[model samples]
Target: MSRERKREGALYLCNQRQRGEEGKASGKEDEREGETRTD
Candidate 1:
């Protein structure tokens, strides 16, 4: 992936972590976001 997508993905990880939620559900959500981002 390009630097921008990596940066944005990192930002999303940080944002999700900041929300104080973790584990399987968030993982699935992140995957969905990544798919959406690709679209």
Candidate 2:
């Protein structure tokens, strides 16, 4: 039971990290678009 719980925790952490990276990527894309628009 403990091992299963640990696995779930690890999976959750990985998912959160991936989500954070995706958010950062989208934010960078938005910045690029804004810069191009201003130019």
Model 1: per-residue Cα lDDT over 1-39, one tens digit each: 699999999999899787756545467877788899999
Whole-model lDDT values for every prediction: 0.81, 0.90
Least accurate 10 contiguous residues by lDDT in model 2: 23-32
Over the full model, what C-alpha lDDT does candidate 1 score relative to the true structure? 0.81
Q: Model 1: residues >4 Å from true position, as ranges?
A: 21-39
Tens digit per residue, CA lDDT, model 2, 1-39: 999999999999999999878878777876788899999
Give Cα distance to truth, residue 30, candidate 1, Å: 18
